[model samples]
Target chain A: MTAPDDTLLLIEDLTVSYGAVEAVRGIDLTVRRGEIVTLLGANGAGKSSTLNAIVGLAPRKARRMEFSGSDLQGVPPETVVRRGLTLVPEGRRVFSSLTVDENLMLGGAKHATRGDPAAVKADMLERFPILAERLHQNAGSLSGGEQQMLAIARALMSSPDLLLLDEPSLGLAPQVVDQIFDLIGSLRERGLTILLVEQNVAQSLEIADRGYVLANGRIELQGSAEELRASPEIQDAYLGA
Target chain B: MDIFLQQLLNALSLGGTYALLALGLAVVFSIIGLINFAHGELMTVTGYAICFALIWGLPFPLAVIAGLSVAMVAAFLMERVAFRPVRGASGTTLLLTSFAVSAILRVLFQNLISARPIPVSIPASLSGVLTVGPLHLGMIQLISIIVTLVMLLGLNLFLHRTMAGRAMRAAAEDFAVLRLMGLRANSVVATAFVISGLLAGVAGLLWVAQRGSVDPLMGALPVLKAFIAAIIGGLGSLSGAVAGGFLLGFIEVILQAYLPESLLPYRDAFAILVVIAVLLFRPQGLLARKTLVKL
Candidate 1:
């Protein structure tokens, strides 16, 4: 359902490097509005770096980085969140010391001054019943899937317009992965823009309106999810036999 | 019996001092995860500022305000320039920089002091005396204990009730995640240090008033006590630091009162032994989560 001209993210000559080692090499990519755009790639293919750079985590040289009409090249990560961009970083970095409710409260911080935080929390608890049951428990005690839900819920607390997910299915059981991906589908259905960096290329592409296969810090192929799924290049890249 | 009551009162007063210092240190360290060696010097600087103001014939209240403001501002600047850039560097680097700043500040303070201990005079109304049966005490200790309690309560409320305080706590948990909450990590850290400096400022004024003398090395004992208390309590728990402070104070005072006269000078040594035992036995203090963090 994404129009070709409705761009949500624009990266022009975005070259990110750490000292002599470049991570994202002047990759120009555009994510259209209101769609699940998956960046599928191998571990060292620079997909994570590209996402990190967009979120202001990478220390690099960017010629231009802008999201949804705002300049983001020099902006810090906090400002990126305020401008409606949230990244569920790799490894599910939940605040292990804080309680589940506390984590949700922290996630809802950006929205605090904007409206009623209590209401947002109640709503999030409604959406994730597992979180509601464990609201008072420390996040570290939760199972891996529950932690991922907590992370996503916390990021959602800020009420971000665009959600960037990095490997949400990294270490979860197959059944739990389905639940997480299901949550993603639900989130997307509610009109949340998502730029996902996922390892499960088949499923990610299945849900993705468009997909980009990145290899060695550059985009190897880009097309509709169906087109990319049917291509031999993607099959060779992801499912090498 | 009379002397016992007197020693208990003295112990409580001492506890108040340590609690304030440790609380400030714990709050700042929790946010940034570095032992700010310069924290003691920040206290010394505030004490000198108050002393300097009193020498200039400023009113006692105004002088204290000026001193507290100056200390908070200095700590705020230290964060923006020095700590922010090297925040993610090795802990050793931050420790060295903080120690260097501490030494430099101490030298600067020593230069400003005359040969004599200047009288940090307060208003007559503020320095009233009170008697309880056989124990005679000045109003300053009572005022300090009350103020410390109020500040601790205020801090608790701030941490629990306010949005900014949640940001500060979240920043302590994970800076990257807090950033996703739309908080600038540096600003959050600055706020914490500024509050710490404010605590140092109040503690400094109380210290010089209680002793009625301002020495260049006055900060050493208090800072040392704070570090010990922090280690004995959990390093990250504010309430634990306060409890450790009171406990340290009571231990020191009880030993000073009950120990044989010949061992009087070593009373401080006894309190330190307790600190060491606590550290050896319960290395994580009383409140930290027992998680194995990867270095």
Candidate 2:
């Protein structure tokens, strides 16, 4: 059981905007240490924007945004990553021209000061055996499912304390999606806190300890997995009841 | 046979200079998508630095190093002050900003130094000829070719072996994602500028050594040719830039050697016409890999 003060990421009244378009409007959220927290919403429902804002990719305003007891308000994305927060962004934007090994090495570059990069990479490749088998091939040659796996593996190379996964199952086969969720579960079991943003409501609830349903840039509902799974509103809107 | 050998040497030396400048331009462009028209100004910066160093009675090798250092500093300042503000602006805006910078630098050079050409006296040995069997090669030309090859080999090693180099290659493909992977965007862009500046510095030294003079506008015609060569090889492709530079060099040399005297004046025009023909066919240049940027 996690302690009350074991919060890994904490945000309050965080607002993200793009020019005149407000994507996330004054939302409060939290992710405790070593827990899989899911943020579920429809497309353009500010899920990606929330993740982007946290990583400093989107223009943001917030009353409070703290990570691991440190202020994360004005930190740039690069610095944010170095502080042990990693985001696997939407679309799995791997360096398509670079070899898989090269991609993995780049991912581990931030950890040069933190740990043995080669050992971290070796461990990552062990977790994703398919990647080790095709280490020299360009990342673009990988199938969509395989690419998603590579993306996750690449993020793990940083040994981040909190990993933000954005739509990891967006365009994968059903079986592949199951495998990705299983991997997420395994990663959680290894003590990595995850903030997963997904549209796969049924599976996400199954694995998530708690969830927040965001709509029109606001959290519409929040509950434990069992409570959210039984909520009629969640069942109707996301589970396609 | 002697004429052929001399012309071959000329082509290689001239092409080497063009390749250096084009690669410089392509490095920054590949990462940021900015066709920095002020790239030539870096060469001009080196030329002026060399002039000052020589005046300070610095030895020839030291002067060259001074020039390279100045060029690199100039590139850093250019990126920070001029380009950084207009970053993420429209393509036209970026192009205009580069032009504005080029114009400003040229004006500064004219006013601060001299509008007229300044003759730079090189060590007598640099202008000497190297005789091998029945052939004679200008010392400067031989040095240019060797230096160019060495630079290319060094660049190859950097790109393939180092983390920073791989980060640059990755930046060229997907810059945003690279930042997500923990590489600082500013540092990567700065590295590109520094490399380009170094190349421009080398090219400038060779150019001044060959011409025996430095002028504010000397970089204009050569840089235009380099820009054209970069386009011919496909913009943003480093290997293509080098290949395009060599090809452009060969075209000019062949034309200079073979074209009728009456047509000699039109050689550049013919070269441009050839470039157009190539673009009409390949469009992507000689070695541009098809980039399917998945949205």
Ten residues in sequence with the least summed lDDT for candidate 2 chain B:
B286-295
Give candidate 2 misplaced runs (Cα > 4 Å).
Answer: A1-4, A110-113, B1-8, B130-136, B289-295
lDDT of 1 at A26: 75
Alpha carbon lDDT at B2, candidate 2: 82
> Who wins the DockQ comparison?
2
lDDT of 2 at A84: 89
Candidate 2 C-alpha lDDT tens digits along B60-165: 8999999999999999999999999887788999999999999999999999899999988789988889998887889999999999999989988998899999
- The chain A TM-scores for the candidates, taken one by one, are 0.94, 0.97
- The estimated TM-scores of all candidates read 0.85, 0.92
Each model's Cα RMSD: 4.0, 2.8
Global lDDT for candidate 2? 0.90
Per-residue lDDT of candidate 1, residues A40-100 (tens digit): 8889888878877888888756656678878888888887888878899898888876788
lDDT (Cα, tens digit) per residue for candidate 2, span A1-241: 2225999999989999988999999999999999999999999999999999999888899988988988889888888888889899998888778888999999989532256788888898899999999899898888888888889988888889999999999988899999999999999999999999999999999999999999999999998999999999998887888
